[model samples]
Target: MNEVEGRGLCLHNNSNGNLITPSSDDDLRNVFHQIRTTKNPAVINYGASWCRVCSQILPSFCQLSNKFPQLSFIYADIDEWPESTQHIRYTPTFHFYRDGERVDEMLGAGEERLRDCLWLHS
Candidate 1:
């Protein structure tokens, strides 16, 4: 089972869905910078809270963080960070970054598919 710990914006991975939420555009930029400079594998989930699909898959996205402890998990709500997320055209879009570059993207909500993708990258 997945247990989320803490709330609000977090820069480092912890118990809260193992997710790092950016509080501002600068923080969001920091996330990207850290991922690139550190060469850490990261999964960024771009979604809006109002979207049903996004809401449904969000918990799973957080839960999966526990399963893939090797990868960094980030949750970016488009509405909350519009300027940085304007490129997101779909709800619940998952972007995978590996070796400092965005390597793949998964659009939509599919638990199995997401799990498989995380496994591949993990």
Candidate 2:
């Protein structure tokens, strides 16, 4: 992964390349707002730091992001953002959005399936 500094923020390509980790609720809200306003395709990985499966698929997820620069990738740790992730039933749940609407969702750490979903949406 690479770290790029921008606007005073040390933006690092987490396990998922191009992934952004919002430090606060406001930051998270802004990310969603930007996605909606820009109507860009985005994928959100709802995972937890303590989840073994979440950790296992991260490398592949990051590689997938690098493969698709047109898509916005984000990581939300359920442990840190419980209120925002209450609906999540499992770790490594991926939510795909396009044109400001969620088009598909996949649960679990299936790297191949995730890549296919991204290919289809992107």
The prediction achieving the highest lDDT against the true structure is 1
lDDT tens digits by residue: candidate 1, 1-122 = 22222333223334644567777778888999999999889999987767888777877877788788889998888888888899999988999999999999999999999999999887
Clashes of each: 0, 2
Q: CA lDDT, every prediction?
A: 0.81, 0.78
Compute the lDDT of residue 121 as modeled in candidate 1: 83
The residue-by-residue lDDT of candidate 2 on 23-108, one tens digit each, is 66677778889888999999998877668888778768777888888899987777676677788988889999999988999999
> In lDDT terms, how accurate is model 2?
0.78
Candidate 1 positional error at 18, Å: 3.6
* Candidate 2 runs further than 4 Å off: 1-17
